[model samples]
Target: MTGERTASGLALEVLQQLWLGGVRDVVLCPGSRSAPFALALDSADRSGDLRLHVRVDERSAGFLALGLSTGSRRPVAVVTTSGTAVGNLLPAVMEAHHTGRRIVVVSADRPERLRGTGANQTTVQAGIFGTFARCHDVTAGVAVDGLSSLVAQACSGAGPTQLNVQLDGDLTPPDPDPLTWWHRPDNRATAQLRQAGDVGVQPSVSVPTDGEPLPLGPRTVVVAGDDAGPAARMLAEAAGWPLVAEPTSGARIGRQALRTGRLLLTTALRDEVERVVVIGHPTLSRPVTGLISDSALEVLSVRGRSGVATDPGRVARVLDVVPRVEAPEDPTWFRRWQAADERLSQLIDSGLAAAQGDSPRASGAPDLSPLAVAAVVGAAVGAHTTLVVGSSNPVRDLDVMATPWPALEHRFVVGNRGLAGIDGMVSTAVGIALGRPRAARTIAYLGDLTFLHDTNGLMVGPSEPRPDLTLVVLNDDGGAIFSTLEQGGRRYADAFERVFATPHGTDLAALCAAHHTAYERVDDLGRLAEALAESPSGARVLEVRVSRADRRAEAAWLRQLAEQAVPGDDPSR
Candidate 1:
């Protein structure tokens, strides 16, 4: 493992150090310059040293790594060649940056001397990810001599990091092989790397259990955003406050959680809120963000791992941990919210049912509406089920239609809510399923456009490890999320179809066939339920065709229902 190392030898050492630093999964994108890394990673995977995922698209590979880290709660690596291949990782890296996932990006670059020499596939690789990820440059000399320290530095971050390795001539491994460097003698690097890994990022501390409890006198509410854990619901319960939890929030499963809270916030009830306890990243709803930004309300936020607490008003009281309640508040306050939430929930249900039509379809199945699709997908989640939701409309629809499960049903829900963009969602979902093998089931609720954005994610090698995933795509033929926004105003109606909707009539079945993945089209609720109930053989797409024409109307109708159901008075005061 020592003297006069070749580029391939350096690549093996880099991988060995990465493995020692607690990286168990690697996603490799194919390229000529990265042959050394690809070969080394393949050998490592074959020898059972680490899991390897191969994707032809670097962007997909990057997000796949992010998803793996998210699912496994450990560091995952994505390797790519030099040039724009490294640039393609920026989106996923940006996502991992805000979400606090450790996705290690290893870019194989031409030797340092190749820079400014008109070399092919040679451009600036270092610092390509900007502030999203810190880059560690490694040349053949630096790698052979101080590879351990470099890897330790790369693995120390709370979020994503990069290793731009400059490989020299003879990128492929020589005779005899160098992948056994981990099994070589005097592997003191392992112990050192483990110690370095121990020095890795620690979770942000919230208010301790013994910490001073927050006053229960105010008309408080817990706003649980994406990734907000059970603490938000527990706090709401302890304080006798309503929990307004987004779908991806782990806190959305309990009785205190209000299904119609988002809509309810738009009512007169918002004026009654005196204080807000915020948890996780809440980027889903305008009402929630508006509430947080309101200068009149006192905001208390539980700190997260991203080193930055979510404080829209810039005046939030940051808690070191989830604070306890001084005492339970009077039941009257809770009852008002409960009554309003229940009434609104009923109204929402009736509205959706009517929109979906009272009479069943010719097939005796319920109508195919976006909310209906989301409702079916949400209901499918059960014990040991991992639900990965896509951003835009699917998550928002799920937030509205999904019922709050009882506590401790073991439903793990997640999404790329850091930036909340529609990029690489398919790959992210696939990574989650592959990463958590023991889950009873894995289901992803995605929009048609979102599904199309990362079709390359379905391009798994036949020999590659495949996850049993059911990807339910709500195909409305366009970006239906915009229909609910101001841009969908009557004044913009003519321009809406061409610009905002951007509908592309893609044949999803044909697309799935191209990827060699199983496909199903569920036009009714009965069929959707049946599809979800079946055992997952491998990754499959359940395309549910919804209507964008009704999106605006349904949204308006729901808002009107909320306004009517919830009285506009501050009853608590």
Candidate 2:
């Protein structure tokens, strides 16, 4: 607890702790209050100990950290200056909290002496990211011991953590100290980690798996949501249950996946459901939401996180791990659902095929369909490829149209379903690409609005490290997703066109050119796949313009066709 150490020394120690705590990347937002951190991080970057990312906007830096941590599955640090700079990180912190990503937020602040004096660029920074992150406010009183302990605790596991460091005096590093990996008694790596007995904050909330395997009832099905991983797929296969997985869910690629699940939930089959098994965070569809929330359905979840991980209605049972539901009580349950899904899938295929027609486009330069575009993007995902899909209609499209192929061995499908607001998607994809293997290729599929929302993310400094990324922008002009909703109906068409479907006709090619990033307009599916095949060292934007007029007609027709797939209900079938 020495009182007279240089601020840089303290900053360097913090960085050391972060590095030892498994932080390989650091995102820095330049400002006066956080200058010590900036300098220390810069020095570390020069030494090649860590990769440093500099984003002028603090908000972008936070999300960049989030993406890096999520993609890397390791703690990533973000350093910001005082006042609003720290506050701006709330959105990303909240997202990390919900998504279970370990993003460490390090914010600099003025010392206690300047309290309530209205100092410039100084305000209450501590406890700013409340509830969303574990906040650590380090004063000079316990500066030595607390900082190290807090950093270790933050990096222990899931969820984001914030470190509010209020330093006094001029901030600059002392001469670079020898890298000793901190003061360890035996010079072993044990000092790098906290003791086994250290009872700090638990990384995430969990429910233990102690209950007996519940007896399977009739019409049982597995519902896999975002970040459900591969467990949901395995469970469905092992238990012989039909799996309805979202696009981001790793379970989406398997054979048991039902493409018409979301729409099916809206039909009569939803009424016949006797039991439900839920995994991951299911937030995409209203039918799934209603199913989980329904008191009539016997809902059970073996997912992590005690609260709202599955049953938002708070009635479904939550377990640490899924129970062994080998076979359903009703033998024909799986068969029924499978048959219906197969029939519906066939109908869907035929409808999309009819829409595509048997002719090649010459004047239209390739007709557009959102589902077709997403399918092409998903198909491009191969070995050493990471697919970062945006949270809009693009993700849902892939959920319906993506098939099991194109190097599925190491493929990754990602989306920001935690907040799902479509912010920082481009930057997040870049971070995801950089977080993966150096030779691995990362491609991002987002809407034009999402691309334009965080265009500043493309403003990377020339000297900074870049990601091998391909940004696929599905330009349907505006919010075509709203068109599929009730608002897109004839009654609200007038208002929907103006507000709900707010289309911004921004020239995406010109936008990429302005940023000095490579740009290309892809129409044909093969050309899109070809663009994805190339492993460029830096990021490039690939625009795919879709037709909104045809999109509306096609979606309506598909839904009409899906509604008829409920066997015995429609005589036309």
Candidate 3:
């Protein structure tokens, strides 16, 4: 393990440890202090052990790591220089810490001799992330052997870890394996304390006794958020509650109970339910929060981890019940919730019918509407498929247009809901696809710009096991949805288009060709359906060309429909 013991070699050793400890993706924001680290990362990436994403902005890089971690259920590493660059990661670190997501932050720091002497781009980084991280460690220089153990510990930890490496001068790569350490087994006891769990810590609450039965009625609704998983089904079946599963919950879209509505809103169950059982963490929607907060119902929040309750102050009861695996044995309560959900289903069908109002289908070139494209692709995908929706218009459109599918029972939705940025959309989607089962098809719905933003994510070599996936790019040329934002007014319209929209004239087919991916362009809905039916068993791009100008009119139509559907109480009006 002998060489010129250089700082870059130490950084490389740390990265190698993480890679061997099951970390596959690393996000790097370039800086001079971290040049050696970046070079080592590039070498590792070339060696095929890890995928490195380069982001210019430290803040965006943090969020990109957060998104990748959230999607893959694995710790993602973020690399940056010391000082303000390291500080830029606070927002994402805080969010991940609170949400029980795992991440590792590696910051390049100045040498000790320069500390407290006003060195350029230097700050107190040893314990700078004290509150936000689970553990913090600093290395004087690169230690190949010790870095492996630290990497293992950080990977296994439930929250973020900060590793500050102080570089001396020139850099060199470390030997792959240095020394091995073994631990003696020991039992230790510590004092137990209880508190309202916050981010980065597990809750200590005891589970409620399964003694007396909960009041069973036909008016209960279960609201599930992202990653609710099998628990959503188990809870609904146990309590006889109708499940209102969000797009991101990854639970079955339609099964025993009806699956309709956008995050518990379309059903409008707030008025009917006397009790609401919430599982998983909070959602990104404001309407869901308002409905839950304003409802005159008893809310029982159940979660496996502590500190997951979004509204601890308003919850009638918080149970530390492990969802699905430890759900109650009773079936009486579930029957009532199921009944209420069925009633809501009827209402939704009636509403859709009324909205249609015998209007003949618009005759034209039979071009695909964004809603039509999303619905068709969503329906055609396999039950065990992993659906990754990009930020901006793709996710929102999918949420609105995706129909209730019985085949999507084992499906999961991966999105950048934490910070909702479009920078790493494709890369995160690809990472998520890689984590799932080999048989499962991973379909990513992305906008044109989003597809271009992380185009490097598609650079999977022939030797790599790429996911059996489809990349559906809804290429409307620009940020079509921004036309509806508040800044879309005449006064700021041009500036909004230039700054926020930032449309790129991308040749998507040409981009896919360069990456050696199967590419198809379709404007006709029928052809689009046929393309999806073929189901190519490799990374393929299905580009649906839509008119950006027409999006404005379609949104207007949807607004009118919502107005008529709700009547008298139109928010847009």
Candidate 4:
């Protein structure tokens, strides 16, 4: 924060600035080049000024930072060695860029002199993230004059920023007492670091205005996608429109929220949709997309993210701030949607109960039906639970089959709907669980592929901090989602299994066994509930074997049922 600085001193000043600038969490990916940052960050953590998380995987480290920052609503930094390690952070940084969260990438680099000279662990990291990060470079032994304020400046834009710190072998603190710099005064506080709630020049999430309001008279439904937050719920309630909130939107609560939102879209209600007010990223179901693609109806989208960008809709309008709408005096139309929602909810519930046999299981496990497994999981994640859903079949199954309750009453739904890719999901949820209160449970519902895909995240070092996470895996042995799509039709059945289904017969329990984590193979619905209620600590895995064969027919039957629930227009005035 002061005049001149040493190689190690620059690293210390950088860390101090990050702490002073309101970054409470920092993730370090261990490597030889970033030794100084690791030591300085450890000292900061020891002093209780900040919390440090160490991850060997740079990709996991990036996502962990993304989760920590999102959970805390504060800027988070990820430090790594140069070259590929820095490159590994691109995914999370790209996500943060679109979602608009502050994730600082601190990479150790060779001096500018050594750059482009075929150095080990050295690549063009200066602009590695490109437009995604507001980048800065700090050479070895450079004066500490502006070093402290760089992090704040990077995060000031409301997205991710990269800092390439060059260092030499004397990686330990230049000064013996890490506390010595504490008393050393500087102008850091006065410097323009991003202050809490400070709006910046970047594409900031638009706040609502008191200008001319968007009329809410036309039939409208708010589609809350991942990270949509409570804004969608507020709009739905304020305007008397049905809320089609996704699990992670945090808007799936109260009476306005339709648990059968997607199904309703597939019915006559879709034809009556005059306008669709889309909020967040509503990419979970095709019905929502089909409704939005209706050129006859007006579509509007609100933007945000979790693991992926959430702007997946064709809208007539896009709002930074949710517009206040005037509710209609007569609520006949909305009532129809609600009425259909209730009827369909009951019918689906009954259908699932009918599908599952009433007989007791001698093995004491739960039913293997995907619906039963997801339902038990829905019941298991009671209040104070953070439910992180994986993409693809698992999330879709839960959306269609799981019982609907008040938002966060059972759990706060979370997912990576930004890019919607199934990368680093297990790690991201792990980060969320670690950041939350210990009393709360963090459970993840994902398909076998999603679970196995991120199995590397479970490869944590023994000394690393572990969270209380119960991973419920629905193992169908293949991609069941394909069965519900055009690919499952007879025309493509010959190539469907090999091409779209992509079955991988690896036993999930065996994978959990190798990782030394608890594994539960559930085949009974009652036993599934019991397993979740026990609240096991650390990481655990539950595998529910399901059949992909019936998925197509079952989905068709559900659509037919929803349609029948909507009665033909009875003009009994």
The candidate maximizing lDDT is 1
What TM-score would every model get versus the actual structure?
0.93, 0.90, 0.70, 0.89
Better of 1 and 4 by TM-score: 1
Candidate that beats the other on lDDT, 2 or 3, i.e. the better one: 2
Candidate 4 residue runs with Cα over 4 Å from true position:
1-4, 140-145, 174-212, 303-315, 326-329, 358-367, 407-411, 568-573
Cα lDDT, all candidates: 0.84, 0.76, 0.64, 0.75
Clash count per candidate: 5, 0, 7, 11
How far does residue 129 in candidate 2 sit from its true spot (Å)?
Answer: 1.7
By descending lDDT, how would the candidates be arranged? 1, 2, 4, 3
lDDT per residue for candidate 3 within 485-548, as digits (tens), equals 6666578966986886777778888888898988888866677777766646778898887656
Predicted candidate 2 versus true structure: per-residue lDDT over 60-158, tens digit per residue: 888888778767777899998888888888888888888878889999889877979988877878888778888888765556566667888888757
State model 1's lDDT. Answer: 0.84
Better of 1 and 2 by TM-score: 1
Measured on C-alpha atoms, candidate 2 has an lDDT of 0.76
Candidate 1 lDDT, tens digit per residue, 137-249? 88777634477877766665678888898899897776655545333213576576556555433332233476458876888889998777888888888888989999888
Residue 348 in candidate 3 has what lDDT?
41
Where does candidate 2 have its weakest 10-residue lDDT segment?
A: 198-207
